[model samples]
Structures are given as structure tokens and as C-alpha cells.
Target: MVKIGIADTTFARFDMGKAAIDELKRNCSAQIVRYTVPGIKDLPVACKKLFDEQHCDIVMALGMPGSKPVDKTCAHEASMGIIICQLMTGRHIIEVFVHEDEAPDARELAALMEKRAREHALNVVKLMFKPKILEKEAGTGQRQGYEDVGPARI
Candidate 1:
């Protein structure tokens, strides 16, 4: 059976990991392992440990940065760390980050978190099982949370 790792942060007010796990369970028979940390900056190491210790095939790093400027900086740093981890592992680490400022209201923020997490979960399935599916959708402006922007006319 395939193994999937989920690395999430408690700093996020929403539970994006649950959404990803739910989506994964609904779609595939992969073994899912989750590691939770206290903040976004901790996600990279958590993911690396998941890959090294738990022997996950792929990982999803989920985080929600607050609306403050400092939070944006932290998010960017965390993103860079995740990228480095991916390169070091030579494996896919799907980064799902939802900034608190993306939505105007709490309800919308929560909704966006769930939508993005679930969509990325499906992407993981496609990547592992059906790469052709994603190849066909390339350049289609496939947004996860909000409506897809669609391909722009050249």
C-alpha cells in the first residue's frame, strides 16, 4: 500500500489536516501518517521526519499564516524551508498554505482552508496514480480554494 504523510501546525486556527485526510481516505487506499507541530516554521522538519522515520511516499505540509506582516515573513521562510526539504528528499511535498488575510471573514477562511486542503489531496492522488490527469490539466489555471481562473487567451 502507498504511504502518505501529513504535516500540519497548531498555529493554524483551522484543521486543514482533517480535510486532507478525509479527502485521501475517500479517494485512495494509501496509509496516512500525520505529524503535528506548533507552528509553520516547524513543518519542514516534521515532514522530513515523516519521510525518514515513518517512510512516507509523499507529504502534504499545511499551514495558515496570520494576517500580520510578521506572519507573512514567517510563512515565506517556512515555504522556503519546505522547498529545500523537497529537494533534499527528492520527493514531493505539496505545500498547502492559506493566509488568514485571504478571506474577509472567519467562515470564508475556514472554507478556503478545507477546499484547498482537499483539492491538494486529490492532486496527490493524481500524482501518485494518474500523472496523465494532471498533465492534461496543466496551464488551465486550476485554483484549489477559489474558482479556477481557467486558461487565459494567448
Candidate 2:
């Protein structure tokens, strides 16, 4: 049996962790270990605990960085921590982040977070158990609903 760990922050309006869990449950049976923290900065430790204590197979670390410049900096730092944790543990940690300032309005932000969470949940399932489901788009560079912002080669 696969154990999925979910680390979520309480700073967001939408319930991204729940959305991810719901999406995951639709595909197959698995035990979901959930840990909620106060903000993005707390995500790394929470995820570490979930892996070391709960024995999760894969982890989804979800956060919503605010609109301030300092918030982005915090997000970057938190991301680095997560990367370090993944390297140390030799496990996959899906970073599910939706910056609060990405959308212009509240409704759009909520919708995007929900959709993104669910999509990433499926990705978690694929990465852990069914790799074939994800292989169909191996090199398509298709990010679902997100617009492509490929690098420039000028």
C-alpha cells in the first residue's frame, strides 16, 4: 500500500490539501497523512516530520505565498528547504505552490489553486505507482491550463 503525505499551509483561502486528497482518492486506494502548518515557511519542517514519522511514500508540500515582495523571498527559501529535504531523504516531494498575487481576483485564484492541487495530486499518484499515465505527455511541455512561458533564445 502507498502512503501519501500532504503538507499544507493555513494562509490560503482555498483548501488545496483537501482538493488533492479528493483527487487522489478517485484513482486508487492509499493512506493519506496530512499535516497543516501556519504558513509557507513552516512547510519544510512539517514535510520532514511527515516523512520521518509517518513513513510516507511521497509528499505533497502545498503553500500560498502572499503578494508582498518579502513573501516571494520567503517562498524561495522554503522551496530550497524542501529541495534539501528531498535530497536528504531520497524521496519525491511535489511542490504545489500558488502565489496569491498570480491572479488579479479572488475567484480566479481560488479556481486555479483547486485545479492545480487536483492536477498535482494525480501527478503524485503517477510518480509513485503508475508511471505510465504520465508518460503520455513526456515531452509535450503541456502544463494543462497554465500558459506556456518557454525560455527566450534571442
Q: Could you say which candidate leads in lDDT?
A: 1
Cα lDDT tens digits for candidate 2, 82-112: 9999998999999999999888999999998
> Over the stretch 1-154, how does candidate 1's per-residue lDDT look in tens digits?
8999999999987999999999999999999999999999999999999999999999999999999999999999999999999999999999999999999999999999999999999999999988999999999999999899999996
What residue pairs clash in candidate 1, if any at all? Answer: none
TM-score of each: 0.98, 0.92
lDDT, residue 66, model 2? 95
* Model 1 regions more than 4 Å off: none
By TM-score, who's the top model here?
1
Cα RMSD to native, each candidate? 0.6, 2.5
Local distance difference test scores for all models: 0.96, 0.89
